[model samples]
Target: MAAATVLEVPGGPDGVREVRVSSPERLMWPADGITKLDLAEYFIAVADPFLRAVGGRPVTLQRFPEGIEGEEFYNKNPPKGLPEWARTVMCTYPSGRRHHQLVIDEVATAIWAAQMNTVTFHPWPVRAEQPDNPDELRIDLDPQPGRTFTDAVEAAYALREVLGELGLTAWPKTSGNRGVHVYARVSPTHEFLDVRHGVIGVARELERRLPDLVTTAWWKEERGERVFVDFNQACRDRTIASAYSPRPLAGAPVSTPVTWDELRDVDPRELTIRTVADLVRQRGDAWEGIDDPAHVGDVANAIALWDKDVHERGLGELNFPPDYPKMPGEPPRVQPSKRRKDREDGDYLAPKAERDAAWGLPVIPPVSPMLAKPVKAIPEGDYLYEPKWDGFRSIVFRSGDTVEIGSRNEKPMTRYFPEVVEAVRASLPEKCVVDGEIVVIGPTGDRLDFELLQQRIHPAASRVRKLSVETPAHFVAFDLLALGDDDLTERPFGERRALLEEALEGVEAPIHLTRATDDPAVAKEWFHQFEGAGLDGIIAKPRDLTYQPDRRVMLKVKHERTADCVVAGYRTHKSGDDAIGSVLLGLYTADGTLMSVGVIGAFPMARRRELFEELQPLVTTFDDHPWAWAEQEAGTRTPRSSEQSRWAAGKDLSFTPLRPERVVEVRYDHMEGVRFRHTAQFVRWRPDRDPESCTYEQLEEPVSFDLADVLGADR
Candidate 1:
């Protein structure tokens, strides 16, 4: 290989930038036998178009000094002797530290970058003048495992449609490897947060439309074989390889921006430095009008799409990159598998059940009652107060290694909650049936996400297993239903409570049996505290009362929590075919994504007649209704079905997906996982409140009292 060579390249309007290349004979593209000098010439040829996309933007170069086959390093700051006119912008990093990053302002800068052995050009989407507000929205379509470039191409088209809906045009490009890059020019008025939100709104919309093929999950484990919409690239200080930059792969492929018309058949790998300028010369620049000042459109239109997503639909801000400050309402940042640390003290990680211990708690299901007046139940003598877990009332049966989770209606639910089954097996005795509420907790264990727990009920075993691994349901055992062969149901509540304590000796989380006391003062504090933390009121079980199956014997002291929910649709009353049976309730997630929380139906005859009269005018046909995908998204993380008919296997599920217009305030005691534990009570129609204000965040209650202290079973 020759040591060095001097090359004079035409520099667009800048006249010329005489660049000296070292080791000009060193093969950068061994496959095509293209050398270092060939790269310098390619950069000069594509300088105009490449500068149009990345010039004036702070850039980081992926430098391969020796060649693509040699060692590489990222060049963030410009070299010591940058050209006189070359600029740099101070950019902040994850450490809150800032550095002056290089800005390729002209064609000469492009050649200089090439001379540094930069195989790729990573440019910020924002110009140097306003680095905080990006004028362009970029989406990186990264193909993950089982996904290919074809998948990314398909995603780009879908993204195009989404962008068009927001009155924006997306320019498609190949990432010069396996991925695709799509960018839309936006007005620079809004800050980085606004642009990032717009990108998330588009990504989430795409994820919804093409869930099987697209993913916006920042967590790597959650993103399966799908095209990841890398919205984080829109964030401030983030950058991507600019058009015409060569990739560091075996083939020196360029990150070539293509016209939308040619996106279908274009192969990314073939667009190398050798061929990029030729294609550009033939088609002119695919981005000729890209950087024109007149072409810059108001980014507000796209921001409005985000507003419509979060403010109206309730899909709030999506997760930010971990290096960012803890964003408001962002889900916990911890990895799903590493969450064991949050609840590790107990038997959560036990390898297997202790079969030699006493097994099978033989007890009948306990009955519960509505005590909208818990204050009245405290003085009723020998009553224990426990927070009503906002989860499904279940009786978990465990024998040896086998565990069965029974729903309140006596249906088999073990399949839907495998982790809970494993938890039951690990914590409880060999043979025991413990009464509990199956709840889903967040990564930090600070809050209960009833909606997340509901996602466990997928028909497919694979999906259920997937969810089990992702969002495992927890069992909050409040009552000891049975103990070994010794039947505890027939025993008094106080005696059964004692046996329950003994049976759950080494039991831990997912099997936490909250200790009860006869003190009325502590009961009052717990009732209010638990309810504040989003838990359903307090449980007050009389000591002398026996377990009563299918009877409301145990007293539940819960304040009737009320929220104004949008009546997205109504189901006919099962009893009388004459009137509307129930109103389907929906709440907005943080990003303004509308989701069905539950339904309310038990209306008086007069109220039912009045509601039917009121709903008739607003009722809409289910065809293409926005809420048509209601049950699919509302019920589980895994798509059970495209419609409601698939929710319950044999239930007569039918309802019209209506326009979301009317809002109603309903009173309900608990949210069992996703949907309301029971039907919500209609308080009255809200004439003043907008349906959008009925956000689910209003229902979140802060977590209190460590489980270890609650159970007195701390490890």
Candidate 2:
């Protein structure tokens, strides 16, 4: 097949062997010895599809260590199996002993070959430093292309001032990658959430000071040109790519630490693995003595000193990353991830008056102007078929003169689209209740950003005011889910939709009429065309299908396929056994713990063989492993006894049983779950992912059963 990529090796294990790919196509998992720069390039190339899915967020790939320390982490588990050539790099030293130093050396070699010069050292985050003490504060900044490093440096200084005002000391370090990291030494008394809050406080202050150029939105899709103050990285187990390591891309790995002064003259793209080592050797490690003990609480107290009035500054109100679920009272940032703003003002309030005048008359429900009646037989063979929008599903209830609007969850969503409430109020004849969806042509026209519409969910009174001015959505009256004192939920969708349209008339803003068609050919064509328009997949409501909240009566088609995987073991070399080099996958059994399922040998060239040799000892005979199990029916092998089983009966084997505690979630296209249908790429470990929670349930059918049923069925 003339290998599909330039780096494909044939007839081998999943990631261990690579083959040539089409010019634009890169291999998924590669053999070990791939440098960080290469790894980065690989990710950049391969992950482009995933990147676009997240709206072009810049991503960085990080590698874990080969081992943690003296304990043989995954000798029997074989973190990930690598080819013999890659494993040879971890040759035994004169002492006849191997150490992680070899893995480090291998990574260093690959880094140089990849032409990467920068390396940021990111150790596991420990509880330390507050945001106040100037000495304890540290900042990591990565300057994007087209932006000046001074912008981040200036942001750091501004953040320091803000944190200092709150009562803390801040320390600054070059991330060795493209960014500079600012750390605030604070009392370790706070949990990750508290520290994040404190950090968010500092970030918000910076955003306020530089509103024209900065933002604290953690979701990449939501942030436009603003600098992102990423406090979410403060979560446990989160790590930034460190200095001098090789990446997965062909020539884009290798991060180098630098002095703040160097940032002024350096371009982030210049920091590749190939150049960082020489640069470090020539310049010596700057800030080498940066390990001095310092206090952390000094900075946190500084934030406490801020005036109550600053709360109005709205400094720390940005969104958090989706990976870490929000804490209570956290903004509803995950519901829909885009921010909306409107430029026109005069027309914003005009619709309310018109709807008010139509109050006594029937109000028009929001509908899919795109759909008409369904045809049992074929008409135009290539026509588009769409489901009729069942009018705006609005739920309104007023308290005195003030009216609060909400969606299915009873969340207060009137703020972002203040105009919707006014229209609703005008259309109602009495001090009554009503429910519908607000539909209008967005400023962008044609397509709708439902995510933008979702921004209306807010609890704060002031946030409501700002949102009203920033993004004013329109009202598209549809089904009256609740009308006056009656709950119409029990009614069929058609009946409710009918009552909705009959109830609202001349209520301004062209009322969208929800309609459906039975033309299968048109339906398929419409599905393809409207996908890019951001409409979630079409629903196959059997004209008879009623409204069922959170039910699968409606089928949805997403743009991609994603799944979660568990981290069963990591590969270590004969040398470096402290830092994990590469990872292995583990699938869960009915009993809960994960068994090593598959391996990903594609690593940056520098860490390849070291990772292989370091992990080789973790291997054991397939027959005797504790976690290893053979599916008697399928003839497939899996892990048994989640604990590391060093001896089978009385015979000593090379492998050891781990605590079976850690679980990770990975995104891949294919899955056997019993083992990866193919090698799985490494994603972040799930500190958020629980090992006991990793069950065989994700493999169940989405259309047929409830999640509870799936889990219970497994039981």
Candidate 3:
């Protein structure tokens, strides 16, 4: 093979132009042994349809100097060696910067690009003459995790149906990967934003039809096992791989255009650069009539559909790409988990320093929740009594639009419960630090479900957002730590409670001021009746005492019950010694299936060693145990390890299974769903009780009561 060669490319100014191809034998697809000269020849073979698709558009070059496996870069600026016959067009980017880009006017220009090692060509949807208005609406169907190319194909077909309803003809092509790209030629009467809205409208319609198979969620975390309709591809400066453009993959696959009839069965891997030229020759271009005047569709109908969605359905503008400037009517750019943190750092909220100074607190945030000591009965004194909320202890700080939920250990939890933040912003004072409990109502809408509440504190922003809507949290404000510049921490409990009640007056559900009374008889009655509503117990606070952090200035009275559970397993102590740390307990359901209830682990060091020795004979393999499913489905969901503690990251959670023969009585406060809310204390060995008889029927069920009643009316 020669080092260089000259090829005569047709459709130039003078009918034909000679373009020099350098390194003729240099491999472009090394695996296939296809050379650079082969690429130039391939362009010549598919020149007519290729020119019709990208000739008058500003094209971006994806080049690899070596081969497909080597380092690659995107080329927007025209390369150094410019032929006089070729031309450049000035285009504006999303950043509002104008620059000249290469325009493929002839087959010689494509051949020259091949000589410069261009493998893929990304063409703008607009013509070079009209850069602001788009002539095509492009949508990229991307299959997220747990989805496949078939899902994208199904979404594309539905998208075609949607476009057809809008009087537009749809064109389908493989994305050269595990996705599909659909295009519709429209009259250049709409600007880029309007065209993007049209695409969004079509995509939303497709999603509405195939809700299970398609999604238009901009966040990847929220698009669960579905084909994501990527409407952003139609935005300004965004482009998709042109039809007949080769992708830099192992097999050198091309983004080949295909008819809707063949798209369902076509294999993208088979449409490689080495075979695409012949395929184009045999079937011709599937989009040959794409540029015909009769084929051009009006975007007015699609834009009207979008307007209907905005006006009637409230389905407004979706999220834009991060690189673009903040768009009007666009949602917040931050993901769900970081939304509150971003607000704290952004100028949208009042500065923390300003809020602190205005609140007159030495430390505005991380106000330690006042501790409580266990009491046997309602204390007789000048005290205020309220039902104890069984949820996460949090101190909420809000100023303007910013709301920060601080955990018991002083960690920022603002990202986890977005609903509570929004509720606080709507109902609470403009600036205050309120002490409250973040709780979630159970599926029955009756009691507080601590398990569901725990599910809201997830790391993935997408999961947090989904759970926020599905299982929204509520804020039960108990005390006011700070009100405006008046630091209420030094104020007596009576004054602070009165101020908190006044501040939270007229608040609504999901944000309420806890009910309190000065009557001891009412407090005693509430302590007995409120447990049915999933409240932990009654908290009696001394009216004369000031706010004290980590001090037991208040008294808590909770109900304690005993349950006989099956001794199922045991985990070793963290000290790496031969001692048992926790004893896993289980109870039989009505269907005779053993379920893990909780663990008991408050034994002394000597007793731990003794228990380890006593339980060694009962040890059994997981294969022979009822909780073996925990090992089989480790990450998805395991009963034993479902709730992970942040402080115990990387801690060994595995335990030795035991024979379900031994029964032990343990003391617990209450139930959180089916499991115990906290660690149970060992009462005694129930040698007289049968493990099979120890079922959920033996447990007491609380009477149903609405959570809204517990939160009381608006006042």
Candidate 4:
């Protein structure tokens, strides 16, 4: 029997409860026959390359939970007494001095039933490689601790200044406690070492500028009489809870967001998920559409927005963390007598783990065996061949009349495809489970546009229904994993296909049987045919393979290329010596429009300097173009080339705003929607070519990367 639990809904029962999960395992792969190694490889494939590009230091991957059922989570323990075998403790906050116990069995039960792979569990600490404590730097001023919010606002400004010099953009997030979590996004070009060093540099600079008021020390013993800049928080694996993540400690788990002005008066505790909606309606989310890095460039601009001189010139104060680590040359910190009894008098860690464990948490053993096997190409004629449609790969489970859809990441995908429900109800066989590709198709032909497919994945149900009317979906099912309560994962591919065909014989609309071929050459040819037809690509599968859940038995082939782009301009610099200002990017638009695609300056100093001089005069600030070449005539907010690089200022301030000029031929691997998904490289410049010729029409209509289909029905 599970222990009883208490649940508090944020903003009342009307509030949203953000779910936070920590998953060290690679559970993001497809559920059908994927090995643990394959999953690890998936992450390594994505993350390791980014790590290597940033100087090859090890950085732990911290992924938050997405799209989980609300009922599947709980906060308070059951009203009934906890299980006798359970170990429980009441957790408390350092400031509020409040407490709560474990014994939350209902939340645990939901998690177990849902098979949620990710949770907000802290990874095992990295001992030696951890970041420096806040106590390491000298102390600063600002007597206002928990006073009017203005004190915090001033502190934020001061901290931003310190971060700016380090070439880091401090993105401010209200902690929903007290204080803020300032995030700085760096190019994946730096590993843990660079991140830690960069964090320290920022902290040290803050300490240097405000030694009397701000302390960069971590040890509480040494952080007396000064506000501490908690530097240890910068450890590579340490992740500040992202927006939408639930915090059990809060009265109601609230995710935090803020406006620059509100920072001065807003109390962190006041921003629970419940209160957030109303605030959002009133002020609007400042961070809306902020996920795309290309749109915002980097955090460098955010740092530049901070007003620093106002903070240094005025009377402001900062309150240091209670348990701040000791710093150099400072006497050990001693807590004020009034606060001694309030500290360390309650339980916190125990209840969090216990409440989570009491509900029979689903334990997933790492799939080391799957990793041991090398990924191989689908053997000749042993598998099925189908064009990999450009859409999300979903595994549909139908138990009786209940149907659920899941993404490759094991997340609830049903919300994004409500229209698929109608098709399943009309066509799917009774008590059956099937695997297939869900693609959005146009009115004319077999060619599927990924942009159209992506449009169907909206969060709103009404919008999805509308889109379904405009562009209906096609379920190209290739495998039958279960029928009439029998798990057929162990069945061979040939048998599964036979079973699938029998099951879907009378399916009504939208759901169609996927075409498969035995010949490898035919399969290869189909790849091009499908591609030319505007479909993604094709997958070749071995016919005799069994359905192994979570194992990679398929291969993906994508049609991709790379292209070189000339450096345009850069944003402001961060705090480090090798810090980059901004790398302005350019590409020719259709009808000879020289549109600015975005910024890209994640390069070493030498590269940055060389590019800056070459492109300086091109900076023109016409009313028609706010960003490009702005400030040629002075009296502009845009920084001058001299400020960008000493060698480039005054060297022909007037740049030839050439008529959509400068041509460079380059290759790109993949195109997402209308833009290159990754950074376009610098290929050789085409000086002899006319710039007008480099129109947006020259950009490819994005090739298809049908990865899902490539990993066919082999595992």
- Please give the CA lDDT of all the candidate structures: 0.73, 0.43, 0.84, 0.46
Query: What tens-digit string does per-residue lDDT give for candidate 1 at 1-715?
Result: 4557777766545676576776677677677687877887888788788878887889988888667776888877565456666677766543333446788877767777777777788988888898777889899999998999999999999999988887777888899889999988988888888888878888888999999999988888999889999989988767888877888776778888898889999988789877888999898999888777665667787777778887888877666665565556766556677766556333332211122122333432222311222343455577766677777778877777977777876677888987887877678887776777887776656566666776777789999989988887777776665566765655687887788777777766656766566887877777666543456667788888666444445667666668788888776765465577877888887887777678887865556767777778787775545465454556532112433555566665567666788888898766654556677888888889888888887885434644334434342
Candidate 1 C-alpha error for residue 148, in Å: 1.7
Q: Model 1: residues >4 Å from true position, as ranges?
A: 1-3, 12-14, 341-715
Candidate 2 lDDT score at position 45: 31
Sorted by TM-score, highest first, which candidate order results? Answer: 3, 1, 4, 2
Model number with the top lDDT? 3
The TM-score that candidate 4 achieves is 0.39
User: Model 4: residues >4 Å from true position, as ranges?
Assistant: 1-383, 443-446, 490-495, 506-508, 544-553, 561-590, 595-664, 669-690, 696-715
Single out the weakest 10-residue window by summed lDDT for candidate 2: 50-59
The RMSD of every model to the true structure, in order and in angstroms, is: 30.2, 25.9, 23.8, 24.7
Q: How do the residues 1-715 of candidate 2 rate in per-residue lDDT, one tens digit apiece?
A: 1222344322233532342222222222233343333443433332222111111111122332321111211111012222233221111111111111112112222222122222222332341122111122334454544555567766766775776666555545444444566655454554554455556566666776888667766555656655567766654434454334333343444444456567456665565444554565577654443344543445445344222324655333334454333334445533343323442323233332233323221221221111122233324432222332212345565433556665543445556566666765666535444544564333555444444454555657787777666666654443444454454545665666556656664454422333344587656555444433334334443444443332333343322334455544554534455544456666667875455565655555445655455444554554543344454234434433322433234432223334455565565423332554445565555667776667667753222112121111210
Candidate 2 regions with alpha-carbon error over 4 angstroms? 1-123, 127-150, 160-178, 185-187, 219-222, 243-253, 294-299, 302-318, 334-715
Ranking by lDDT: 3, 1, 4, 2
Which candidate leads in TM-score?
3
Cα-based lDDT at residue 141, candidate 4: 25
TM-score, every prediction: 0.47, 0.32, 0.49, 0.39
Give me candidate 3's TM-score against the actual structure: 0.49
Clashes per candidate (backbone, < 3 Å) = 33, 180, 0, 100
